[model samples]
Every structure is written in C-alpha cells, then in structure tokens.
Target: MEYLVLALKGGCMGVADIIPGVSGGTMAFITGIYDQLIDAVRSFDFEFIKKLFKLDLIGAFEGPHLRFLLPLLFGLVLAMVSVANLMHYLLGTHPVEVWALFFGLIAASIIVVGRRIGEASVSNVLIGIAGAVFSYLLVGMIPVTTPDQLWFVFLCATISICAMILPGISGAFILLLLGKYEYITGALRNPADPGNAAILLAFVGGCIVGVSLFSRVLHYFLERHHSATVSLLTGFMAGAMRKVWPWKEVLDTVTIRGKVHVLSEANVLPPAYDSSFMLALALAGAGFSGVIFLEWLSSANRG
Candidate 1:
C-alpha cells in the first residue's frame, strides 16, 4: 500500500513534468516526498558507486534507498512512456485548457509552499521577491539558436535536470527556452528511430550526472535553511504563473529547423466575457480544487 501510494505520487510528478511551466519537484514537494526523493538521489555518491562496481548488490540497494526509489521510478517511467505523446498532442491542440489547469496548480502550490514559512520575515520576503523577479525575467527571454549536436544535448540535459529537481522551476520550460524540449521529447517518444538512440543515451547520462550532483547541493541547503529555501521556491512558482497564464497574445513567430513556433508572446486579459472565457475559468477552478483535494489526502495520510 505504501509503495502504491508512492508510485501514485510519482505519477503526479510525471504529469507535472510533462507540462512546460510545471516542475516534478514541485509536485514531489506538494505530495510530501521532496526530501526523501532528494536524499535518494543524493545517495548515489562515490561510496555507493564503489559498492555497485564491486557487485555488492545488497549494500548498493540498501544504501541508496532503492526500496523507496524503485516504485517511484517505475511510476515515473510508466507515465513518461504512456503519456508523453498525449501531452504533446494536448499542448498542440488544447493548449488553452492545458495551461489553465497548470496555472491553477501552480497558484495553489505557491500558497502551499508559502505557508511552510510559518512566520514570514522581512529578509525572507526580500529573498522571495528576488526569486520571483529573477524567474519572471528568465522565463520571458526569447530562445536563440542552439546546436543540435549530441554534446549540446548532453549539456542541456545536465542543466535541465538540475532545474527539474528544484521546486518551482520547470526543467521542461528550461528545455523549451533552450529549444531542445521538442527535440528530446521527440526522441523519447520514438527511441527506436535510428539516431534517437544516441540522443537518449547522452541525455540520460547527463540526467544521471546532474541529478547526482545537484541533489546533494539541494539537500544540504534544504536541511540547513528550510524556511528561506521554501520561501524562494514559493516565489519562483508564483512568478512562473506568467508563463502558464491561459491567455497570451503572440507577437511574432520564428522558424526553428523548419518548424514555426511562437517567437514572443505577452500575457493578456481574456478578450471577452464570453463562453470560452467562462469555460477556461471553470477549468481553472477545477484545477485549483484538484490541488486542494490532494492536500487533504496528504494531510489525512499523515494523520
């Protein structure tokens, strides 16, 4: 039952990860597994690797918390394999509805994280503001041309994996900015393609390297400065709402590798007080309610 619960949590993380402005780490935090997930990733250090190489399977598995990791990983992989293409289709087809849902999710997440601060101090407030402004500006940047080479893919994956694990920051958004989101997801959805195998290998290698190193640093800071870190992460999620906002006015389009994509967009008020706008509002409400339900379930489990 416990493993099943953890796997379900992982599925939630995977769903969040598939969206551009949503983070799996944010879902993990909301679902009460953030610290455990970070610790599990952090366990793959020098000593653990040594044990694995020496064929000390028991030591390796026990040391790294694989009992916890295996089910979570299984769920994550299952969701990725089953839903990646569905997410792509949804993003391409029902974008407004999808963004509306995630917008509500992130908004609720901000509130949830903010409450963790217990009592907000001026210092933490300033830190939170700084985080919000930085994230807002970062997400608004236009993408420039980047190399499609395998080495570049590895580097992007490394950076993206770091972002993926951080609360409030979305690694998929980072990949979108770097122009590699579609490139990598395409390979993931079709690994049997001739060249995609190499791409997936390099990408996974970089993810391993990034997660192993970044998780340690994150775990250290989180242990020492829990309140401040949560405050900043809250701000990050708050600011990220700009990207997830359901209504946007596209200013221009650009061609990337023969594909036309939005070059720039500005958040806009819904054009009219009409049925479409009202439906979007309802969807947002549904998303917000979903988060509240999840919170209730989390608390009930704890009790």
Candidate 2:
C-alpha cells in the first residue's frame, strides 16, 4: 500500500515533467518525498558498485533503496509514456486553464517552502532575492540555435538533468533554452531507428552521470544548509511564476521537425473581466487549494 502511494506520487511527477514550465522535482517536493528522493539517489554509492563488481547481484539489489525507488521509477516512466498525448492535446486546446493551474500550484509552493524557513535572517533574505533574480532572468532568456551533434546532445542531457531535479527548474524548459527540446522529442517519436536509438542511449548515459554527481552536491547542501537551501528554492519557484502566467503574447515562432515551436513570447494581462477570466480565476483557486489539501494529507500521514 505504501509503495502504491509512492508510485501515485511518482505518476504526478511524471505528468508535471511533460509540461514545459513544470518541474518533476516540484511534484516530489509537494508530495513530501523530496528528502527521500535525494536519499534514494545517494544510496547508489561505492557499496552498491562493489557488490556489483563482486558479482553479488542480490547484494547489489539490496545495497541501495531499490524497493523505494523502483516503484516511483515505474510510475514515472509509465505516466510519461502514457499521458504525453493527452497532456499535449490539453495544452494545445485549453492553454489558459492549464497554465493558470500550474501558476497557482507554484505560487502555493513558494509559500509552503518559505514557511519551512521559520524566521528569516538578512543574509537568507538576500540569498532568496538573488535566487529569484537569477531564475527570473533565466526563464526569460531566448532560446539559442545549436548543433545536432552527438556530443552536444550528451552535454545537453547532462546539464539539463540537473535542472530537472531542481524544484523550480524545468528540465524540459532547460532543453528548450538549449535548443534541443524539439530535437529530443522528435527522436523519441522514432526511437526504434538506429540514429534515434543512439541518441537516446547517449542521453541516458549522460543522465546517469549527471544525476550521480549532482545528487551528492545537492544532498550535502540540503543536509548542512537546510533553511538557506530551501529559502533559495522557494525564491526560485516565486520567480518562475513569470513563466507560468496564464496569458502570453507570442512574439515569435519557428517550425522544427515540421512542428511549430514558440521561439519568443511575453506574459500579458487578460484583456478584461469576462467569462474566460472567471473560469481561469476559479481554476487557479482550485489549484491553490489542492496544494493545501496535499499538505494536510502529508501532515496526517506523518502524524
């Protein structure tokens, strides 16, 4: 039953990963599994490798927190594979409502994460502001044109995977900024092809390397600088609010692999008070309330 619940949380993270501005790490944080997640990643240490090298397969299997990670991974993969079409359709058809919900979600997340800092100090506040400024500038940067070479693709994965594990940073958005979102998604469509297979394999290798190294750094800071780390993360989510705002005036677009991609866009205010505005406001409220409910549920579980 516990594993089932963990998988359910993983599925939510998977769905979040499909959205451009949403982070799977945000889902994990909201679902109260963020600390466990970091630990799970850190569990793959020298002991596990030593067991593998000694051909003690069972020992290796037991070496890490596989029992916890396996179910979450299964659900994450299942949702990403299964719900991609449905999410794409919804984003295309009901863009406003969708973004509004996520905007509300992240807004609430900022509060939740902030509350954990207890009382704030001057240095922490400055750190938070700096983080917000960095993320705001980051999300607003224009996408650059880049090569389709294998090494560059590997580099993109290694870098973006770090962003993916961050609560406020969307790995997908990172890919977009790196000019590889379309390229990678296109390869996913025909993964059985030789070229696509190689690309996917390279991406997987990069992710493994990236996550192994990055998780340790994150764990060290989080364990030692809990309040400051969380404060910066809260600031990151707060700044990302600009990206998920429901209204946007698209400035430019380009076609890639026969698909139209938004190359530039600006967030805008809704034109007027009307039925559309009311619906968006209502959805935002619901999304906000959903997080509060999840927090309550998480507290109950802990109690």
Candidate 3:
C-alpha cells in the first residue's frame, strides 16, 4: 500500500515532468515532498562516494540519507518510465483537456508560491517582475541548434538539469529549445540504435554534471533566502501559465516514421452571445477552482 501510494504520486509527477510547461518540482511542492527531495539530493557527499567506490552497498546507501532518497527515487524513476508511454498516448488524443488541467495547476501554483513572499518590497517586486518578463519572453524564443559534440552535450545537461530542478521550468522544454529534445527523446524511445545510444549517453552525462553543480546553488538559496527565491520562482511560474493554456488550433500535422506530429497555434474562443462561451467559461472556472482546492489541501497538510 505504501509503495503503491508512492508510485502513484511519482507517476503523477512524472507526467508533469514530461509535459512542456508543467514542472515536476511544482508537483513535488504541491504534494509536500519538495523539501525532502532537496534534502536527499543534498545528502550526496564524499563519504557516500567513498563507500560507492569501495563497493560497500550498505555503507554507501546509509552514508548518504538514502532512507529518504531511495524510496522517493524509486518512485520517481518508475513514474518517469511509465508515464512516458502514458503521456505519449494522452497528448495524442486529449491534448486540450490535458493542457487545461496543467494550465489551472500552474495558475494556482503562482498564487500559492507568490503568497510565500512576505513583503512587497520595491526590490522584490522589481525582481519578481523581472523574473516574470524574462521567463515569458524566454519561452517564446525559437529553438537553437547546438553542436552534438560531447562537451556541448555536457554543458546542455548542466543547464537543462538546473531548469529541471526549478519549480516553473520544464527540462524537456529546455531541451526542445536547445534542439536536443527530439534527439534525447528519440534516444529514449529507440535505445538499440547506435545514434540514439550516443545521444542518450551524452544527455545522461550532461544531466549528472548539471545536477551536481546546480543542487549546491539551489540548496544555498533555499536555506539562506527562502522567501525571495520562492517569490521569484512563483513569478516565473505565473508567466509560464501563458504556455499551458488549453485552447489551441492545430496548424499542421505531419507523419514521421509512421507517427503523427502536431503543430498548433494558440486560439481564443469567440465570445458568442450564447451557450458555447458559457460552457468554456465554466470549464475554465472549474479548472481554476480545482487548483484552489489542491492549494487548500496543501496548506491544510502544512498546518
């Protein structure tokens, strides 16, 4: 039962991580495991390394705070692998509704995270605005090509992983912007291919280097300036809600390797003087309210 619960939560988080605008970190925050996850990552240390090199599994696991980490990671990994297929299916069939829920979730997250900033100081407000505008503009930019060189892969991994840990940004989306998403996701989907293997290996190497470095920075910020950091993250998330809005019109669909790829444009539904607009408004309202409910649950748990 315990394992099942963990797996279910992890699966939900994995689904969030797979999506372009959704954040696994946000899901972790909503679910009340964000701090624990950070602590586990922070526990990786020299003693843990020494035990691993010695092939002392028991010592290695115990030296780091593996008790918190192992189960959580088991959950996360299982969810990631499982949800990859599930998301592929859902996004194929119900893209709008799926995005709608995420849109609502992120909108709610902005409020939840924003309230954590105790004071609306001039600097903090400016910082918050800067964070929002920067992310908002950053999200709209086109993808850039990167040399598929191993060193570049390592750098990409470092940067992408940092974004992955942040509450608002999506690592996969970052890869998409970096022109590596297709390469990496392709590798995962077809590991037997040599090209795919190379891409996957490079990406994995990049993620390791990135995570190790960024974790320290994140740990410092969280410990020393929790409110300010959270406020900025909240602002980033608020701006990011633009990317997740549910209504999109399909611009084109292309068949690649016997699979369909959709290209879409954001659309606003016409405000009719009648019932369709009412229905959409209701759906949007329901979506927004659902997030508030989740926030309420989260606060209740914290209290």
Candidate 4:
C-alpha cells in the first residue's frame, strides 16, 4: 500500500513533467516528497559504487534508496506512457485553454514559492530578480534550426533534464527552446520509428548523466543556501510565465520531419469583453484556482 501510494505520487509528477511549463519537481514538492526524492537520487554516489565493486549487488541497489525510487519511477514511466498523446492533442486543439491553465499554474507557483523563501533579503531579492530576468530572456528567444545529429540530441536531453528536476523550470520547455520538444515527444508517442529507438536510448542515457551530476549541485545549494535557492527558483517560475502566456501571434512556421512547428510567436493581448475572450479568462481563473486548491490540500495533509 505504501509503495502504491508512492507510485501514485510518481504518476502525478510524470503528468506535471509532460506539460511544457509545469515541473515534475514542483509536483514532488506539492506532494510532500521533494526532499525524499532528491535524497534518493543523490544517494547514487561513491558509497553505492563501492558496494557495487564489492559485488554486493543488493547492497548497492538498496544503499541508494532504490526501495523508494523503483515504484516512483515506475509510476512516472506509466504516466508518460499513458498521457503523452493526450497532452499533445490538447496542446494542438485547445491551445488557449491549455496555455491559460499553465499561466495560472505558474502564477500560483510564484506566490507559493515566494512564501516558502520566508525572509526577503536585499541580496536574495536581487538574486531572484536576476534569475527571473535570465529565464524570461531565455524563453523569449526564437527557436533556431538545430541539427538532427544524435550528439546534439543527446546534449539537449542533458540540458533539459537538469531543468526538469528543478522546482520551477520545465524540461519540456527547455527542449522547446532547443527545438527538440516535438521530436522527442513524437518519438515517445510513436515508438516504432526506427530512428526513434536510438534517439530515445540516447536521451535516457543523457537523462541519467544529467540527473546524476545536477542533482548533487541542487542538493548542495538546497541544503546550504535554502532561502537563496528558493528565491532563485521562485524567480524562475515568475520568468517562465512568458512561455505559457495564453495569447500569441505566430509570425512564422517551420515544417520539421513533415510536421508544422511554430518557428516564431509574439505575445499578444486578447480582444476586450468578447465571449471567446471571456471563456479564456474563465479558464485561466479555473487554472489559478486549481493551484490554490492543491496548495490547500498540501497544507491540510501536512496538518
């Protein structure tokens, strides 16, 4: 029953990860498993390797808290398998509603994370502002033509996976910046593509390397500089709002692998007081309310 519960939490994280502006780490934090998840991942270190060298396979696995990790990972994989296509469809067909929901989610996240930072120092505030500015600029950049080469594909995974584990940053959004979101998500959706198998394998490898290296750095900062780290992450969530803004004008489109992609988009305001516009506002409100509800639920659970 405990393992099942953990897997359920993992599934929730996976769903968050599937969305471009949402973070699996945020899901973990909301679900009250963020620290445990980080510790489990961080445990894959020299001690575990020593156990492996000593030929204590069970010890090696168990030493790294795999007992807690396996079920959670299984749940995450299950969710990605189940919901990838559904997310793709919604993003394609109901983009406004989807982006509106994401906008609300991020807006709420900024508030939540800011509160978590507790005290506001001048240095911390400045640091946070810097983070937000960096992310805002990063997300606003135009997607360029990227190479189809396997190595660059691997590098994309390496970079995005780092963001994926952070509380506010979205791995999928990072991949979008690198021009690999569609390709990777498409590969996951259609596993039979001959080239996809290799790409997916390489991606998995990159994830492992990326997560292993990056998790330790995050763990150190989180432990040693909790408030500053939280502030920076809060800023990141604030900056990411630009990517998920509900209204955008597509300046140009590019076809990649025979699929149309938005090559450039400029944010725009919706028409005033129209029915469609009102509906979008309602959806954004619902999304905002949803995050508040989650925060309440989390608090109640803690109590």
Stretches off by above 4 angstroms in model 2 are 189-195
Highest TM-score, which number?
1
Residues 166-234 of candidate 2 have per-residue lDDT tens digits of 988888889889988767866765678999989888887888788888999999989899888988887
Q: Model 1, 302: alpha-carbon shift in Å?
A: 1.5
Residues 145-261, candidate 1, lDDT per residue (tens digit)? 678899999999999998888777899889988989888888879888879999989998999998989888888778898888888888888878888999989999998678888
- The digit string of per-residue lDDT tens for model 3 on 131-238 reads 888777766655556676767776777788778777888777787677666656556666778877776677777876777667878888888987778878887787
TM-score to native of every candidate shown: 0.96, 0.94, 0.82, 0.91
Give the winner by lDDT: 1 or 3. Answer: 1
Q: Candidate 2, clashing residue pairs?
A: none
Number of the candidate with higher TM-score, 3 or 4: 4
lDDT of 4 by residue, 1-303 (tens): 989989998998888788877888877766678789889889999888798999999888876887799999999988987899999999889888888877877787777778888778998999899989988887777766678778988899999999888877889878887888877887888676788888888888899889989999999999999999989988887888888898889999988778887867889997466887777788888877877887888789789
Q: Candidate 4 has what TM-score?
A: 0.91
Question: After superposing candidate 4, which stretches have Cα over 4 Å from the reference?
Answer: 192-194
Stretches of model 1 off by over 4 angstroms after superposition:
none
lDDT of each: 0.85, 0.85, 0.71, 0.84
Backbone clash count for every predicted candidate, in the order shown: 0, 0, 1, 0
Q: How well does candidate 4 match the true structure, expressed as C-alpha RMSD?
A: 2.1
lDDT of 2: 0.85
| lDDT score of residue 291 within candidate 3 | 65
